[model samples]
Target: MNLHLHGDAIPEGLSRRARSFVASHGVRADATPLEPYRERWLALGVPGEVIDRAVAYQERWGGLVLPPAPVYECGPRYLYADVPEPSHGGGWWFVGGEPRASVAFSFMIGPNGEFGLWGDTWAPLHASVEGWVESLALTHHASQWAKQVTRLHGDEVEGLSLDDFEPVEEVQGIVDTWWRGSDSLVALHNGEAECFSGRVRRVALVYSGLDKWGLHGQ
Candidate 1:
């Protein structure tokens, strides 16, 4: 995944609010040091590159604060929820997420620089934090588009495409993934309603939360 970095290596394609948050609060080199957190990550056996990338992100965005509401409250605090070692084992380090969601999912990274969605199950996602950032941008765009499409079509949001919205090169992969897989776009509609009913019940992409992937409804 190619992450577009703006000045100071801040990944582009983040929501406007997210970008602004970074602009205002992201720590610079001269800001508060993050060595303590780095030490903690190191103690947890997180890889050096991953730790560097994460710390660089903290310095750039002032520590992983996500958008408000449904979005998970992630940051250094959540990333380090477990110290020494993650409770889940498998050399996975707990990252962050909302545990109360219908499908509880959390972010995790393996010692080999593999990042993934970890719940009661695990789903590999990106190869690195950088890739994860790119995926996050795509997920954010897809979720927003899904919301708008749902509003516009009401009960008929199936087969929605980015063409319906402004063209975004970055989201092309997500769109492709959605179109190619039945499990990609999971919707909640009245079971009684006709399948493919044009009614816009509720539409959600697999990677909506940046933590949850595929179906959690089981």
Candidate 2:
């Protein structure tokens, strides 16, 4: 997986608010060393290759911006005790994103180098840190676009299916990112829809509601 280090570059097609958020808090080109965080991952027994890739990602991008939320952070035991285990066997280590918000999105890295998004429930997002970064950048943009649509067409959007809006095609090829169905649309549920490229089918309905935004894996 090729890493797309978005050092201070606001992804194209984000709203003014989203663009401003990215410009203000996007990853820094001159990021601090992540060596200090290695011990934390090592303590959790994260695989060496996963540690290396994750650390290298942070070093290059400084941190990720999933806006409306703060940059992703890494540390020991960042996962809340409440977070359930993934169905697979690997030990889960917290990657980043706000974990305490009413609608939170937290990332977890598995021992086998798998990455998952914990929002309402755990869903495998990417296979590696590089893939995760690319998917996340696209997710952030999609999220901002959703917010813009909500503000502009709130009432009209109620009960409206995602098919009404054009399918977002820019995020293709970011591994583990696109929804499985070819005709998937961002269906409005409770006033929001998690319209991104690679969202899984099971969690698609749950993600449509904005209320589920920060309810990480609950």
CA lDDT scores, all candidates in order: 0.39, 0.38
50, model 1: CA deviation in Å?
A: 7.9
| Whole-model lDDT, model 2 | 0.38
Error of 1 at 36 (Å): 3.8
Off by over 4 Å in 2: 1-32, 37-44, 69-87, 91-93, 100-105, 109-115, 119-121, 125-169, 172-218
Worst ten-residue run, lDDT, model 1?
187-196
The digit string of per-residue lDDT tens for model 1 on 28-147 reads 332343556777777767766555644544444333433332222221221222322343544435353223344345555545444455544544444444444433444444465332
lDDT agreement of model 1 with the native: 0.39
Residue pairs in collision within model 1: 26-62, 154-200, 155-198, 155-199, 155-200, 156-198, 156-199, 156-200
Across 159-195, the per-residue lDDT of candidate 2 in tens digits comes to 3444444433322222233331222223222201232
